[model samples]
Target chain A: MRDSRGAEFDDFVRTRSAVLLRVAFLLTGDRHAAEDLLQEVLEQLYVRWRRVQSSPEAYARRALVNRSINRWRWRARRPEQSLGDHDGVARDHADTVAVRELVVGALRALPARQRAAVVLRYLEDLPVVDVAAAMGCSEGAVKSHASRGLARLRGALAESSLVMPITGTGSSR
Target chain B: MTMNDSDVRGILHRATDDLVSPPGLLAEVRRGGRRRVVRRRAVLAAVCAAVVAVPVAGVLDLPGNAGDAPIASPLLDEPTRGDLATDDGYLRQVRAVWQRQIAQSDDPPRGEPNIVWAGDTPAGPAAYVAHATVHGMTVGFVKPTVDGPRVSTLTQVTDTETDGLEQAALLGPQRDVLLVLDFGQPVEFSPQLRYAPGGKVERTFEPVVFRDGAAVLSVPPQRTKLTVALSRTPVERENMIHIDGTSEIYFPDHKDRPGPPLVRYTLPGAEQVWGIDPVAEDVIAPTKALAEYLDPVGAHTHNGSPLLWVYGATPDGRRLLMETVQYDDDPSHVIALLAGPQLPFEAVASTTADWSAPLPVRLRLPDDQGVVVVAEGSALSYRVGDGQWTDAGRNAALLPATATEVRVTDANGTTTTVPVGS
Candidate 1:
């Protein structure tokens, strides 16, 4: 009986690992850290597999966001490593690389809560309510964080010349 | 080109395009999960043992007294004699006893063990550990004696008024451990312990008072020396006062106040302190009342200095008075001067006009490296070193470490320059 349940968990992981990994990558802004974040979430989910298996995707996503935010907060107390050192991807066009660098740096510069709000709102395409649920805050808080996060990112991108002027409001999704 | 939300999404997708989880990620996670489940079971068993042991030990007083019993058989599987030699070994022994306690009981909920302290106790070598349960945090003492490892539940340190463990410390020559049970309120009361060498744990009814948000305990090598100081910057908002500050522990004999404080609590810059002033009278009146209250009971003034007093509430809403005596020749003494049933906040507010305002001290900075200080007046200004005095807005300010002097000006245009120690 336990074996069958384990098999089900294995199947869930196999099916959802890629999407979860993508979300983790966007949340952490680094491939290595994303892999670590996802592994931790999966391990936690597995420990309480009976309950979490019912809503595996939702539980996994929430855990990822929470653990990512925790990691961001912990990293804030220590000296940060240079981003270029952790970029595992091969260099492509210099212009594209510079643009990617600016965008990633801007995302990292936002406070942990704001960064989480942006990742959930844009990359995961979660609704404002769902993002709030994932962040363990209210919908108004989510909207406030997202708005401030986007405004900061816009300012950063403009200063770096990575993108054109940012204007107009956007829905959370 | 201004990037819209869609463009932002597109860029995020590209950033993560090449990322892939390791091939053995699933296997690793599964293995990690199994280990976590095992630990969880062990912790649950321990909590269950504690919950059951509380009543049985209370009724039967099992294992007799610590001094009388010949070393019983190893309660836990760990090597007691060899392991008790080192701190790491002793902690492992402590963990083993905790695990054994859990293993002996029926299935219970799992929780984390906060190892408060590991050192030589009067009962030999011991470690203080606490685990949370559905009810509250249960503190335990694990002692590794020549006979075997002895584990006993100290007491349930919290009630429904508070939910979790905030801070803990083992103080005094007897290694009396103090546990702060709640942090939700500005004022916190911690239970102190008196450990008889033979495994007898007696809880002194007199609680350690933490003024503002400060909880600190200091126990020097000399058994007679102990000092507890609670200091914080007072902030008033929304008709209530917030007491948030740092706590420092000092020995009375240390004239130069050498080295760093034994313990310090630095709250975040953004965390608000909130609580009602439990005392009804004016600050001086309350101080005098408290002094008169303690005088008959052997509480004396520390020299000629005015008695410094702080009033707050326990988790259960009881009013508590904490006072300190500064002795010129001897070390300063701090105690929980008085405690009584709840006082109505409304009644207190009605009588006192400035109960929520900052305590009046011209300027009070940390005696150590930091130049931050809490001032009393509204139109307050401060200067660090010989620099121009900047407007400090009647709150705390973190100045440069190289600062040589601190100057503060009050709303009435009175300025005072504090002499910085070399």
Candidate 2:
């Protein structure tokens, strides 16, 4: 018989991969790297599908955070590999590409944990509790990180010509 | 413009609305899941096998696949080496940190973490040989982050814990590293590349520093060929732990120079091979192997000249580029890739590289992304079925998914068309 777990995992990926993929892309700010990250996470989820099937999205989200944080580690030591901006342009959004670059750069520059927290809080639009869960930290800590990240991104935007109104002390909403 | 949460989401959405999650991800995940299962079985067999001279922790060298990522380092019984090895003060500090972790943990460690090796890195003083027991152990990589000394648990092998051992790397909240480890065995650091092109195994090992039980290797920054050896001795460059998905950042002094690369083809060209990134080096220079392979093809760019070429990039920006290594000893179209913008350059696509009859390489970049293309020659271009030819550019390019043929033209204007598909 076809494996029930495989079917379930397949269904989850088929249905949720779009947003998960977007989460990864926003977190890494590189298209290929995002796909790579999502694939790896999904692969792990498939292996542990039985255990995490109940909350596969939560499990996958946490794994994404850990891996992105690890990517930060990778960058520190294995600096030869990095996010290349050669062709990350969205043809339909050419007008806002410059704005997106500023946002991505500001986001990418934050501390790995802070970046994870902020991306989860803002881009994924997860609650502070969910961000904290994904990041393996306290909700209070998530708020602090997101606040710092939002402020920094705002500061970066303010300094740049693309001054995106990404201003907030933190994601109070 | 005051950015709110909606603004951020809307912007990020617009930026990536085009990335519709590349097709066949489920299939890719399944294939990788199967591999992981098989790898687990293999590890189980290896562990359950009769204990020999050393633990047979050799990563299974599946043809055309990258090695498994190592998270826990093998327990070291050998003597330690690190300038900080003798530093009682720093050692005490590192130990105190470990102790602090042990004292604070809800689920405490079985025993004190044995500081296997300690070294003064460009980052700061770091230690190896983390919390362990007889059967399994947790790899704790301590690094000086902007915050403080954080002990990020990488992974656990059998029963212990491991987040993902970045052995050559000291993983924490701050760093991700790839490494080779030997559990409960000692393999000295002596790299001997049996680099022969004619049916002989070509292996190039990065320079490794061994401490008591832990060893720190200087991994090549360039795209490297995976070396899967079954030798129990260190001569085979055994127990290489690799991780995937490395990308662009600076801080060139990440790894200690493992002497000089095999060959350096720094061609002065206006064409930005990698666009102001560091020149790609043949860390495992292909001189002899390269000559043998290329001489047969009768295809080469001369004078140790290196030409950087782009395979095609995805509209969302993922691309592959290779540099032709034509070094000493009449090097011809010898191949290597500059991976992405700042990824390591592995010497080749696979072990069975034959330039005479060019073969497509099945690449498993660290990002877990795979792309296949016959990335070769000085200048290349491709075309789909009955379509216009687009500049493949440089030494090689990722074959477009719909590409039916690749037209390879040398500087001499001799053109050869090879049917290509991914």
Candidate 3:
């Protein structure tokens, strides 16, 4: 039974790590930082694996969000903390790399909480309630943060050469 | 500049499409977890021992134990350990950085920082075991440079956190090479990292003395890919296995979730066997009406595990599906097919490998039927032979038989080539 549980946890990490890593990358805006954050969370998750087996994905999501926020707060409170992002990374003009960099740059500009709210609501397509739960905030806060985040993204991405205007379907509630 | 939620969603997916979790993460997690369990057990034993021999009231009144005492942080209790622990000048420099950073921080520590460990590493001058506290939580710190010290990369010192085998890639004084490794075990495991950046693969072995489970290595700044190998026992340099995971140019694909449990779909007629299950349901009907007209394909199978079938459809109101097929003295394979009301299902395409992520199931039908692609993100597209892309419907798409690549484009015009390579 213990072996089975271990196998199950390994399976979860193997199957869901890509999605989870993507979420971490979106939250932290740096691949190295994202990997570091994910390793830390995975350790914590392993410690609590049995309790969260039924819905490990949910637990992982919440952990990622909380840790990202905590790291941001720590950086703010401690100047020794590495204040790094994608700013110094060399730009890749290749089709895929360029677009991804532009998108990440736009996201990195937003505050941590707003970034989380926007990523959860729009990128992950979680409902307002779920987004609120992930970020430990109310639905109203998620909506406001998402709205403001989307506006900021629009303004930043508007300057990109490949930007395209999307018609509002009003379906993304 | 105005964009809708859909636009943002697409761009976000585009941005993160390439981020894959590093390999060996599970191993690292399990290792950390075991350490934590050991720490927990040790703590419990210590608590029990303390209960029996509770230190005298005043003796136990340590700096942090007594309430609101104007003493140094509790982290200072442990004497610093490392080769350079006695170097006053180096320790002073580390202390200065810690004090300056803490002073500039919003919630400054109540006392001076403790310099625990400082020494030269492959990544240059590095320090670990430097401790500080805010709000009573002890955080461990490591400064890797004399130029700019960024201690944020360090994990906090805690009851459960492992003091052994701390591994991190940190920026050093040069800012060009940043790698630090702590293998908190007594064994002298030789660590080698193979780096191949679109060119010839080179194995770089780090040189170090494992002083109390800490070693630092330098990895150049420009790195395209990395492979890791650690030997439990030291071995000759030439005898070690050199080709460690360099062939795996990219992450192995795995599904986010297992497919629906294989159930016996009984229509009792004649279900034809498609070479494999429909990989991309570019067009699919909700009802199993297509399956209703086919023969009971699973019933006919006489060998191996029972066939698992997933049904789908095509654009021209035809039946399409993918399923498992087994042959005499042969391993089972997944096949896709196309059929009409008047025709029996015939094998169109098949994949001999397991299906999963950072990639999609890509199968090109026999005789140029078309290419079918099933992937994570919906709203995908495919193009064949350098032709313009055609929408694959939703998460799955069926393209012309000549289609060589599957591409997903966000609303913001970012296109990602879904992994459909051979």
Candidate 4:
């Protein structure tokens, strides 16, 4: 029975790791950091597979977001590391690459909490309540983070001549 | 021109469109999971053994039937003013307390026990020690007194919630210790030190907004007055003046460039002040070699015309200056001139491509002396004292010496001169 459960967990990991990686990458701006975050969440999920198996995807997503945000906070309190010039733009097309760099740079510039809110709300398309749950904050707090984050991103993009307007009440889509 | 909600959403989706998990990720995760499971089981077994032994030992020591002598209580002993002056001494005292606790326990501390002494607290000395347990990592704080060290309540720090403790030294002669427990979650942290009288000071970074190439931080319900001082000339106290709740701090892209500020504040009713580096990104000198080269020269520069100007130092004690004329069609033409103690203002190199404002340039001196200039938006070019110009790609170049002034040629074929000095 334990071997069968392990096989089942392996199957879940093989299928969901790719989707989770994208979420982790967006949460953390670096690919290597993203993988580390995903691996950590997966390890925890494996330990509590019996309880989390009912909705493993949601559990994994929550753990990923929470851990990534926590890591960001830890880093902020500590001494800052050198900022590299590379923006991980490895696309063949120049225009697409420029836009990607701009978006990623702007996203990274947001404060840790705000960035997490923005990624969960827009990128992952999670509702405000879900985002709040994932971030360990109230729904109202999540809305505030997403609103402020969107405003900052719009302002940053405007500086680069890529103007974006923040609209909507930041509710569930 | 205006991007709507969908546009912003689309941009985010496109940014992460290409990201995919790498191979062998699952296998690695499985191995780590197995290790964690094994550690958990070991800790559980130890706990169960301790539970059974505690009752058995109690029964064995029933009133008069003394098979075992009464365990000497370390706490009952008179407190000694041990030498807790140095940090190492304080750490030793903390470790001794942990060893005593483990010896008394039915099951010894599993895994490698590690202890870190933060510093001397008002209570005496404080340290954070951790040992492995069946559940996870068991973390405990050692609060020392004149008598000896006492272990505070132990908290389990699991792999998931691994945000640890921070030892912040408060201002005063006593140098009271402030232990900050950061649980890597998004909850607000209002850590209060026993020695501090003021209501807890909550530190939070208001959302970051960039204005005029500077990051503006806003903290609401203003608690303490903040002063942003440049790290290079901290004594100058040329603070970035701001309103009560909002302050604008600049993080310069180039390390040599002035104004990566540090924020200092004192909590209300607290006599001592604390300082922290506010910028999230590290500020390193753009080029170590170029910065070293410029150190001796002490060069400085300002543009006479709005078009172009350059001034900086060389590795040796020589100053440099360069000026350029503004060209309408070809903004990239940077007229590099060598003007110092020995060299005249001779045009050394120029770029044919269009360049942007704030033209970056580095001077190579003593050896293959030349100026490596990066016209913004153009390729980096290197030229040795009026020699053949070589394309050195688009990255910033390190030159042997610093330039005192940089000159540029304008579209009207008019040359503008600028003064650069150190």
Candidate 5:
């Protein structure tokens, strides 16, 4: 039984931690902070491993998202810093890099909940119900956030002339 | 770029590609797990060796749907463990929750909020309170107990989002009549209710086979009324019921109770796990007289057991005290001192004076780094080289602890030596 439980927990961490880390990074804008968020969530999952393993990923995602939102409150509010045009970070795929930057920039600009909804729905490919579950909101609320987040992303990308570059077929520059 | 779902998915995928896990985290997790497992096994072995086996019967507290019940399988794989007995159980719990809400509502006696309850027939209930305007008279009620599975009677109400699904039991001759109310929809109700009078048997039957499954039943279009329904579960499963004729039903006059604006911290070692701005006009606007009637309530935990809770607000409106009741034991010590004369809004930097303040402890740091005093009302300041306490500005945010035999000079240069984390 102990072995099985350990195996189950390992499987959970392997499969879901990447997605959770990405969302955490988007919300926190720091890789170290994202890792900390994942650690906190994994610790929580460890404590409730037996009860949550069946839906371990879902439970972890919700905990991570909520923790991010809650963390935004108490800390000293920092002025959002834009990653200047992916500068040295952009690699071979210029369009992909640009799109990635656009997404990161757009996400950084959004209020926390909408960004969470977009990440859950479009990025993670979670169902509307699951997204709502992660967001602690109704399905309608999830839809509204998705709509608003998409609009904001579009507007942000349009301002940057990078929308067509990324979404238009990923043509190598 | 205006992106659709597919486009957005692509961007998110690429943006997250490089964020793979750092090496050694998994190893650390395994090491921790092994330690815990060994400890647990050792404890179990000790218990087994210490005593002769004594059997303790485990309590079987399964609800009505223990086996092969319709609502037994949760929609998602995760089971919702709570007071979900059946639809009836849901209705009872919803009623209890609402009754408490109504009694404790800070609203005046004249302002009765509309109560919305949704659930399954033999399940638990979920209720919502909304201050909205509704058109048409819709009365919702539950039938009394008749022992028997076949005492399954059904009544139908207007199929709308607000009204949700309707449920009822028929008794005596009333069991034969299917009374349906049509606010206007495709479905029609046949006047028959299923009941065996007095027996402890209520078996399930197709609700549509009875006339209660109506799209639109006829009633004089009543205007502006409060609506209530008693069912056994969440309304997510009851999307099939629609009140077609009631397209004009408006959910106007909505006034949700405002809450504090929350701020989350990403920096390391920040003691404030979560903070909320209570001074937002939408949150604590027009401070309630009851806000002054605030008192410390006992600490408790929420479902997921996070350390969060409400304790009491002040009367004069200068300060509001909140305790992270769910996070730890003895929440009284963890009270949040807000800025109002009672409870003020959350600001970037706040100084709390009331309740209790952290005792000013004098500290002396090593020579490389000066002593940085951190406390409320006063600013944190520290300087590197040989300098007077006046060298570092009062509002200096961070102070380096570098040199050996450093001095922890308070905002006032009056220095004292104390062990760190003592």
Candidate 6:
């Protein structure tokens, strides 16, 4: 029975690994770090495999955001680990790739809760209610996180040449 | 639809436009409906192991294959150290030797050692300890694995608290008699001490175990003169640092640095500690026990953030780097570079916007000879067999063993290596 169950779980994992990796990549930017983050989150999922199969994506997304936020938070302490243009690209050309860089920078600049809210609402495109459910927070809190996340992201974008527009300040959309 | 923040919103979408690769990720709503079926069965099965069943949506579509994506190797060969070396190596060696001694002790710790205090050493005014533990786990392969006593030094009379009738005897200025409340595997250590209002400080520690359980501590009767109750409230991790994802930069000194820090909070139960966004400069002159996981497979030359390497020194002072690069076919494993003791560099230096922003660079012994860096516009090429740097662009040359004085050529044909002094 254990073998069968493990096999079933393995089958599900193999089929979905690629998709999960993509989401993780988008969430983290660092491929290797993303893999590590995904692995840990998956291991956690494996520990609770039974309940996960029902709604794995939501659980995994939440875990990914939480872990990413923690990683970002901890990384902030170590100054030498920041990602800046080091590929020897010209300053003018640097802005060409700045879009991805700017967006990721904005996402990372947010507080953990706010980042999760923004990712869920904008990137993940989930409704406010679902975002709240995934984050284990109240709908009102989710609304606040989204608002704060957008505002912070906007502030971050202003520094770069690429400017972005955000929506939903605080009240109803 | 329309707003003043539209520019930023559009820019945000554009930046993250190609961030996700498999494309169908955001469009997974239909598949989610099907996942409901799988979650029901999974929950039923989890109930048997007595493990808490996370909600179905939480892990419904998680990846199963370890190598679904080309994985970067976490292990690598220790790199050669050139300059910034210290006796930090002694820390790891001592830990190993001490762990062996602790394991050989006929009377092992009662259970997992609850950290009483952890920080700097010598147990003096400058030193800081995390918390006290009643009992500690047996120093074995399965659970708690450390050499010698869990806490290296017992600094002051106020270092630990006691519970039950266990007694505290001053063994020495360096070592204190730590009474264990229980003596067995999976033991519980919970000590209650009388904390005088301001004098009795509550050091908030980051949460160690996500689950809540009862812990037992060993303490002397006199220490528990007053039983101060502990709150189960969760506190935000203060004194924190963050690594921005896109920039690959670390913001160590945030707006929250000088605030009142949390001293006592959580327990240390993780098998290993990982430092995510380590500033390259921070790793140059590292403290003891700061080792990190490096993934070579993940190394790639992005526009702004190119090479991302993670390194750390273990509880034993050995520093290692998980050097990652994008060109490697295998994006899973990291090439481990053990910077020699002479210049024990751990993490890579994060690049700054102004290019020359002064970042904190720690050296084991600043008075000693330091490293010199030269950036040359001339192309550098090296093969496996080549011994040193050559002007020849394509020829493979033997890589320099340590972080040494090197000439780096910027995008423009400019080159220079700065000679650094302690």
Candidate with maximal DockQ: 3
lDDT of each: 0.46, 0.50, 0.52, 0.45, 0.39, 0.34
Best by TM-score: 3
Task: Report the error of model 2 at residue B90, Å.
Answer: 59
**TM-score of predicted chain B versus true chain B for each candidate:** 0.23, 0.33, 0.40, 0.24, 0.20, 0.21
Question: Model 2: runs farther than 4 Å from truth?
Answer: A72-89, A159-173, B50-422
Provide the global lDDT of candidate 5 against the true structure.
0.39
| Residue B293's lDDT in candidate 6 | 29
Give a tens-digit lDDT track for model 2, residues B1-422: 56666666665555544444432355446645655555566666655563452456544443213323222443533445566778888777777777776555433356556676777655566666566533344455555566656554443333221212333442333333333343443433323224355223344433344444344444323222212211223432112232221211111222211111112223223134435422221123223333333322111112212222323333234333433433222323334333445454333443332344443332323332333444344466778798899885644355545667777776567777877633
Q: Indicate the worst ten consecutive residues by lDDT in candidate 6 chain B.
A: B258-267
Cα lDDT tens digits, model 3, A1-173, are 03334456766775577677778888988766776677667767887887989988888899999999889532221112211221112123275577777878888999989999888877778899988888888999989998888889888987776566433321110
Runs off by more than 4 Å, candidate 1: A1-4, A72-100, A159-173, B55-422
- Report the lDDT tens digits of candidate 6 across residue range B196-236: 22112223222222111112222233221212122222211
Q: DockQ of candidates 1 onward, in order?
A: 0.11, 0.14, 0.20, 0.13, 0.11, 0.11
Ten contiguous residues with the weakest lDDT in model 4 chain B: B236-245
User: How is the predicted docking of candidate 2 categorized under the CAPRI scheme?
Assistant: incorrect
Deviation in Å, model 3, residue B349 alpha carbon = 18
Query: Which has the higher TM-score value, candidate number 3 or candidate number 5?
Result: 3
How well does each candidate reproduce the native contacts, as fnat?
0.25, 0.27, 0.34, 0.27, 0.20, 0.13
Candidate 4 docking quality: incorrect, acceptable, medium or high:
incorrect
Q: In candidate 5, what are the lDDT values of residues B292-397, reduced to their tens digit?
A: 2111111111111122222222222323333221211111222233344334333111111121222232222223222223332233333335554433222112
- lDDT (10s digit) by residue, model 3, range B1-422: 55667777877866765454443455555655655566567657756666656654323333223324433433355566666677787777677766665555444465556665566665555565444445333344455644654453333333423332333343443333433334342222223332222111233343445554354444443222322333222422211221111212121121111112222221112123333333221122211232222221101111223334545555454566665433221333555766776685655556652333323356766555556665433457776667787766644455666667778654455667864554
Expressed as tens digits, the lDDT of each residue in B1-422 for candidate 4 is: 55556777877766665443433345446545755675477567756776787776743322212313222212112122223324566667677787777555433355445653244444455555666544334456566555677765444333432322211112222223333322212222122111111111122222222222122122122222112111111111111111111110111231111111111111121111102221111111121111111111111111112333344333333333333322112122333433345443444444332333444333233344444443332344344444555444332333434344444333344433222222
Poorly placed runs, candidate 5 (over 4 Å)? A1-4, A72-98, A165-173, B30-422
Off by over 4 Å in 4: A72-89, A161-173, B52-422
Which whole-number lDDT from 0 to 100 does residue B190 have in model 3? Answer: 28
